[model samples]
Target chain A: MSALRRVVRAFPSLLRVGLAEMVAYRAEVIVWILTSTLPLVMLAVWDRVAQDGAVQGFGQGDFARYFAVALVVRQLTGTWVVWELNQQIRTGSLSAALLKPTHPLAWFAAESLATMPIRAVVLIPLIAVIALWRPEMGVGFEPANAPAFVLSVLLAFGVHFLVQTIFGCLAFWLDQSLGLFNVWFAVWALFSGYIAPIALMPDGLRAAVEWLPFRALLGIPVEIGAGLATGPAVWSGLLVQLSWLASCAVLAAFVWRRGVLRYGAVGA
Target chain B: MSGRAFRAILAQWRAAWMAALQYRSNFLADTLVTALWVGWTIVPLWFVFHRAPERLAGWSYDESLLVTGFFMMLQGVLEALIEPNLRGLVEHVRHGTLDFVLLKPVDSQVLVSFGRVVPAKAMLSVGGLVVVLVGIARLPVAPDLGALLVAPVLLMAGLAALYGLWLLVVSTSFWFVRVDNLSYLLTSILDAGRWPMGLYRPALRAILTFVVPVGIMTTWPALALRGLMRPTDVAVSLTIAATMLVTSRLVWRRAVASYTSASS
Candidate 1:
């Protein structure tokens, strides 16, 4: 409880420092944002595939809308904390964060969130251009699912952050944890509806993926935002997603505690 | 090139090889990762084809594998050769450590371009060929003598063009503080080349084919192998690739001159 209080109190200053760090590395931040444009590339391929009439009940508009919403959701939820953790640990710079008064995880959280302003600056124009040029893409607000979509996105961000932190903690012991993370990412890419919509997935894969946490982090919010999910579907997805949030939170706390205990920093 | 220049380049690569040998585990891990990545690259296609529209703009499942195989080979070259060198070039520029490199006796372009290599990453090209063979096995007709001959040529040309494109991206750092993001953006955009060019809308198709030429780099070669490409396309792809190479080299020279322009 006291740790939570310290984290909350320190967060604003942490965020401010993180924002300054982001400004200094603003170009690299743009690169990070641009790399997530994989969704747009997939959008192009799937949009063309859908031109042959509805496959699994998704027309060109449906494909475009799903991917457009997906782009926003991806940018909102994404962070490369795992890669950063690996680099910091390897270079021994993580010692500074360890020396901080607050929990080091608070600083990581701030570092991840501070990139939001730049994302918004870049995405607003992008979304506006898409809205204007391809109104048929229907990149817009969904009033009914809007409130739930917001809640789901925030929870999804929590899941993504915690999951990266859990894997990031692996750097304390592993020679290179990024390789292990790649295996997870490869699975996530397949099951998270990254290449194609989950609705279009084969029956067996869809059935399995629906219960998994992979989709909870990305696909659910995208589905809600694209108007694919209704009242019950949205709530049920949020239910599954909330459980992932809780599970990952517990796992991350445990893993980080264990990893930090064994951590030996060789720094000046 | 003179034998002495050739020897200097060889020595640079040798040093890089010895440096890489210092990290022995990376070789084993990276080779394993490359092999896994080869299989994972096919999974998306598996999902897309799990149902049946039969073809992606007339590309059958086995045929699409040819394109994916070629794309994998290109990524192998990118990781093994292009990215490591470009990264070194950019870091040198950013940190102003480039002065040490500039003081060297050898040609700076050769020094930077062949400056770093990850030989382990080239294992992906070997893995890519296995995929190509797997793709060829399921074909309705075996690849002919001409295809057997032409595929490797296009692969080399595609690699040359890939380096040129990366070189072009890195050249901008000479003027702009950082255009490293542009290289990353180019990489993600090139992800589109994994599919048939016909799978894109016309506007994007033209851009990828000519403007960026990623389609020419990967898909045109695959098409040539299948005997599906026009004879003129071979000439055009080779010509365009050569043109991009020469143009980027010229641009690089001009960019390098600017770096020295202020100091003089």
Candidate 2:
């Protein structure tokens, strides 16, 4: 109870610092968001493929919707905590973070959330382009499922944050966990609907990907945003996403404790 | 081109090689990451093309693979030979280290361009070559000796155009303090080059060919290797490459003249 109170108390300050940092690195943040342009590239290819006829129920219109939403979802939920945590761990700056009363993850979460506004700057133009140019992409609001969509996007953000933090903690033992992250990113590019809509994937592959966290992190919100998954589908997806989130949070906490122990043993 | 400059460039490469050797584990890890990236790119080609009966924007599956190979090879060369150096140019300019590099007897442009060569990163090109060979073997007829000879020449021309494009981006550091973000624009543009330029609309295709020349750097080489390129196309591509190179040199000279050291 006290710990929870403490983190809640620290939130505002942490967020303030995070916002300052974001402003300082505004150009970098824009570049980072812009570099998530693979979806646009994929959109072009998929758009071309759908030119002749629909592929797996995805017409060119559907491709535009899927990829545009995918880009928005990706930019919103993407986590760079692995890179931050890895650098801190490697450089021994984590020791300072450990000295803080609140958990370091709380600070990371604050930093991640704080940068969203700047990231949203990039998304506005995309939203404008999509809204003005390709209004038929069907990315508008659904009042009925709006709650579910928001919940899914929020949970997706949580899931990615936890997953990246878990991977970041691997820096305690590994030479460079970012390399492993590259491997994860490569796989996620295929499975997470960044490259293609999961619905358009082969049956076997789609079935296999459904249970993975990558799909929950990117594909679900995108599906919901596009109005593909609704009612029971959205409910079941939220349940699975919640479970994954819980598992990752527990795992991250466990790893942080163990990593701190190891850090202590090394006398850092 | 002078012997002294050649020795200086060789010494820079030696330093780069030794630095790369020092991080063998990181090198191996990078190699694996790049290989997985290759798979990441190829699987999409299979997913998109296999589902449809028609050629994607006029390129067949095997032909698409050849484009993919050229994309990988060109990207690998840029990653190994060019990116590490050019990506840091903005930083050097910002930190005022470029002033010392300019003060050196060697040509600043040559030193900056040829300074870093990571043998491990070049493994991406080796991997790309394997893909290219596999793509060639998959074709109905092997490339004739003339086509084989033509491929490397076109490949060099493509590389020159790409370097010219990169130089155009990096040269902006003289006026723009935060031009590092500009590199992201370059990569984003190049990502479109992974496929044939014909896949894009006419306007985009023209931009990719004439403005960025990603088509010349990637598609032309792949086409030459596959014996699909025409004499006129090859001549046009070489002309674009030379023009871009000359223009970039002119821009570099102008940018350098205007450079004011950040330390000052």
Q: Can you write out model 2's per-residue Cα lDDT over B135-159, one digit (the tens) per residue?
A: 8888777888888888888888888
Where does model 2 exceed 4 Å of error? A131-133, A139-143, A264-268, B14-33, B141-146, B174-178, B258-264
All candidates: TM-score: 0.91, 0.91
Q: What are the clashing pairs of model 2?
A: none
Model 1: per-residue Cα lDDT over B1-264, one tens digit each: 566667887887898778777788977777788888899898887877675478878888888898899889888888888898988888888777777778878777777887678888888888888888888888888879888777778777777888888899898888885877788788888888888787877888999877778888778767876788676877887887898889889998897777743233
Q: Is the docking of candidate 2 incorrect, acceptable, medium or high quality?
A: medium
Model 1 RMSD in Å is: 2.9
Over A124-198, each residue of candidate 1 has an lDDT whose tens digit, in order, gives: 877776566457766334679989999999998999999998888999898468878978988898899877899
The lDDT values for all models are 0.83, 0.83
